[model samples]
Target: MTLSFFQKFWSVLANDIMAVISSFFHLGQLLTAINHTFISLIPKIPNPSLVSHYRPISLCNTLYKQILDNVMIAHDYLHFLNGKHKGNNRLMAIKLDMSKAYDKIE
Candidate 1:
């Protein structure tokens, strides 16, 4: 079913899920499945040899996707503002992937 359908018909279920997510976050608990991901390498050229010739992408799960959707809204607004800036003003937005950094911390 579409997102709109879910929101219209299963609003309570949606709200409950959000509440659960909020509670889990407040308690500093995260599900292992949310951290689990599969990395796939796709070749950029037909005859690829070195790792640089391929691009590695992670196939993330639903909860991660939901988090990204919210984050991307902010990014979208930053992109729009950067595009609309006039005169000598320059707007810069930076995106950093800190997941690997988090994994290394004890």
Candidate 2:
């Protein structure tokens, strides 16, 4: 978690990382510690004209990211990315009005 770790690792090739890992222990859940989250707006250009130019950055605990990644995998959110499985029936999406989609998201 220190800047020196990242600096030294990239500076040399045969650095021994075992010394840093020999003192590690299991990090069990601690609910009392407040989770810190902040949204950073990354502008695509030096001068932005629209909201589309902004990118959102959400940072959270490492364990929280691991849990969320597993949940997304279980839901098959990107199952259509690979063409390995063939579908028997054609799927159709009927869109009525998508302009005001975020008005009633809850």
Best model per lDDT: 1
lDDT (CA) per prediction? 0.70, 0.49
TM-score of 2: 0.32
Candidate 1 TM-score to native: 0.41
Candidate 2 lDDT by residue in tens digits, 1-106: 2334445675462243333233232344344322555566778788998988877756554333455566588456445444334576544334356446522211
How many residue pairs clash in model 1?
0
After superposing all C-alphas onto the true structure, candidate 1 shows an RMSD in angstroms of 10.1
Please list all clashing residue pairs in model 2, or write none if there are none.
Answer: none
- Give the per-residue lDDT of model 1 (tens digit) for 2-36: 35554576766678668768978898886677667
Question: Candidate 1 regions off by >4 Å?
Answer: 1-27, 67-106
